[model samples]
Target: MDQTTLLLFIAATFVVAGFVKGVIGLGLPTIAVGILGVVMAPAQAAALLVIPNLVTNSWQLSGPKLKAIALRLWPMLAGTCLGTWAGAGLLEKAKDGSATLWLGVALVLYALVGLKAAKLRVPAAHEAWLGPVVGVLTGVSTAATGVFVLPAVPYLQALGFEKEELVQALGLSFIVSTVALAFGLIGAGALDWTIAGASLLALLPALAGMGVGQAIRQRISAATFKLCFFAGLLALGCYLVLRAMG
Candidate 1:
């Protein structure tokens, strides 16, 4: 694609991604990375995600239980940082398209789980050990696929937080993941000034889309929209997998 075309494509992609997040309260990174992977390496797409994800998730850090949540989730967050750092070069090293393949697989699994809407409860006794393990796994996945919603999201859901708390926890985790991923990308030499600037520009369309999505949420059924979203994700995942294979 030409320069103008690429710019337009990126803007449109973020708009759609932001819309998804506004309606569902998550998915900006997943949607943006998955779609951008169609035109570039996962590492490059992930670099573009840093600014948008960080800025958007920062607002989610607010809430009364922020300190408690941080204290409770510190081990997991620490593990994410360590694991991401350790695996920071995976995407850059996977030069034979394996990174793209794994990205597709991650999207497919995430979409499937969302479609199933499975409910799992993690006993408090296991959390101490399990949280860090899940964090490491999530970080590794983020390093490899530029997406971090698999085990992390599921494990968080199983933590038994109330509705508001869960939302806040997710935002917190995403912020940590985004920051960790940014460092990982930088270490891999994938993030730089040009990509950072482009990511910043992408933020405007993303925020605009979020506004529109929030407006639409009041008029439509979230459950119905979620179903469609997962369905679309599944298709997109399949396409990515097939394209990578070909």
Candidate 2:
């Protein structure tokens, strides 16, 4: 794609991504990276994700529960960082197609789980062992696919956090994962100033779309929208998988 075309497509991607996030409170990076992977290399798509994911998640983390959540989740966060760092090494050595394949697989799995309304519970005492394991897997997934909602989200849900607390915890985990993923991308030499600059600029459209989505959310049923969103993701995932196989 030409420069202008690439820029417009990326901006559009984030707008859609942000709109979804505003409506349901998550999925910005996953949506963006998933769609963009169709047009570009996966590492490049991942590089484009760094700035928006970090900034938005940081804003989300500003809620009052930040400190307590951070304190409680530090061990998991540390394990995530280590896993991302290690996974980056693998990503650096692999072909871009591998990343794209992983992204597709993740989208399919996440969509299926969401559609099923799957839930699990973990006793508080088990968190110390379980959290780090989930964190490591989430980090590795992030490094491989630039999508971070795996065992992490499920594990967090299992922890029995209240709604608001869960939101804040998700934000904190995304922030930590985004930061770690950025470092991983850098270490793999997948990030450079050009992509970083474009990523920074994409924030405007994302936030604007968020505003639009927030307004829409007031009138529409979120459950319906989320169902539509997951359906789209499933279709997109299928396409990506097929293309990769070809």
Candidate 3:
């Protein structure tokens, strides 16, 4: 495909993905990776996703509940940095390993669990160790698999947090993962200026979709929102598996 057509298609996907994440607090990678995987390497997909992730989560961070979430989730953020570093390192160094399959499986499982979890709420308190564990998985996934945002969501949901709290947590987690993944991708020499430009261009759609998402938030039932989110995850997983098989 030509550059303009590819960019338009990618932009449309970004809008939908942002809308979904705006409404649902997840699906940034599920949407970006699933579609972009067909057209680019996983590294490119990740690079394309970085700015949008930053922008979307930055909006989410302004919520009134954001401070509380920051206080509660700092451990996880710290842990994510370490976990991501380790995970990214292993993927980078392990010559025989295929991180793509791991990413696919995680995406499918996350969708399944998250879909079921939409009925519940985010927890007020979660395990201290959970952050580092999920963070590592998330980081490694991004470095090797391109979907590092997965490990944080289901567990956070099971913790029974408020809706806004949940959104902020997911948003924050993705932003953190994006940072780690950017570093990993950079260290691996996979970052690109053209793709970074594309990601920046996506900021408008990201914000626009977030506006739609916020508007839809009141109307969205947790079950329906989760169902759509998980469905996207499943579809993305299948696509990843197929790509690996190919």
Candidate 4:
């Protein structure tokens, strides 16, 4: 394919990905990779998500929100760093089925455990493990099943965060994942100029989508959001399995 065509396609995909993320606060990587994986390798698809995720979420930084939650998420961030380092080696050795198979398994358990967990009020000290857990998965899967971060939300709510604080936390996590992912990809020598340029250009669509998503989020209820998000993720997981199997 020509440069223009590839650019157009990626831009379109990024826009949709950004919209989902903008509205739901967590679909950028999940939606983008599912589509990009159809055309590119998972590694390449991952490279595209890094910068955009960082850029969009960074725009969300309110003074009090950043100050308050960034401190609380410190433990999780440290865990994320460690998890990124450790998970990189395993990711290199891990083959096709590992992520999709486990993600499917994780999804089932998420349905069972996560439902109960989301309803309870858990303290931060108790659920602190979520960061490293999310980081390891994000690092390895390149954000494929990075929705692992989503489950941590219930625990955050249990800790009694308002909507803005919750949004900030999720946005900040995306920033951290983007940075960790950048380093991981660089170590793997996945950071060529062609991909970098493409990724930079792709941000335009991502920004546009984020605008649309922010607007949509207001119309949806939390339960409806979770249900729709789960259904979308299930379909994504199934598609990944088929791709790996084929």
Model 4 segments more than 4 A misplaced: 1-5, 89-117, 124-158, 218-226
Ranking by TM-score: 1, 2, 3, 4
lDDT of prediction 1 = 0.89
Candidate 4 per-residue lDDT over residues 1-246, each given as its tens digit: 688898788899999889877776776776786677666665677777767877877865665768868877776666665666555533333456454554444454444443444456655666567655644544444433433344444444566777788777777766776787667666766666777887787888999988987888888786676676667666666666666666
Candidate 3 Cα outliers beyond 4 Å, as residue runs: 63-68, 89-99, 118-126, 219-222
Q: In model 4, what is the error at residue 73, expressed in angstroms?
A: 1.6
Question: Could you tell me the lDDT of residue 69 within candidate 2?
Answer: 88
Compare candidates 3 and 4 on lDDT and give the better one. 3
Error of 1 at 68 (Å): 0.9
What TM-score fits each model? Answer: 0.98, 0.95, 0.83, 0.79
lDDT winner: 1
Worst 10 contiguous positions by lDDT, candidate 4: 139-148
Q: For model 1, name the residue pairs that clash.
A: none
- The lDDT-based order of candidates, best leading, equals 1, 2, 3, 4
Compared with the true structure, what per-residue lDDT tens digits does model 3 show for residues 1-246?
999999788887788877887776677777777677667666677777878887777766668877878777777777777766665544444343255566677788877776665554433444666666666666556667777656676657666677777777777777887888777766766666876787798778767877788799888696677777788788888777766766
Residue-level lDDT of model 1, residues 47-90, one tens digit each, is 88888888777777788998898899988988888888889999
Q: What is the lDDT of residue 136 in candidate 3?
A: 65
Poorest lDDT segment (10 consecutive residues) of candidate 3: 89-98
TM-score (C-alpha, index-matched) for candidate 3: 0.83
Q: Is candidate 2 or candidate 3 better by lDDT?
A: 2
Cα-based lDDT for every prediction: 0.89, 0.84, 0.71, 0.65
Error of 4 at 180 (Å): 0.9
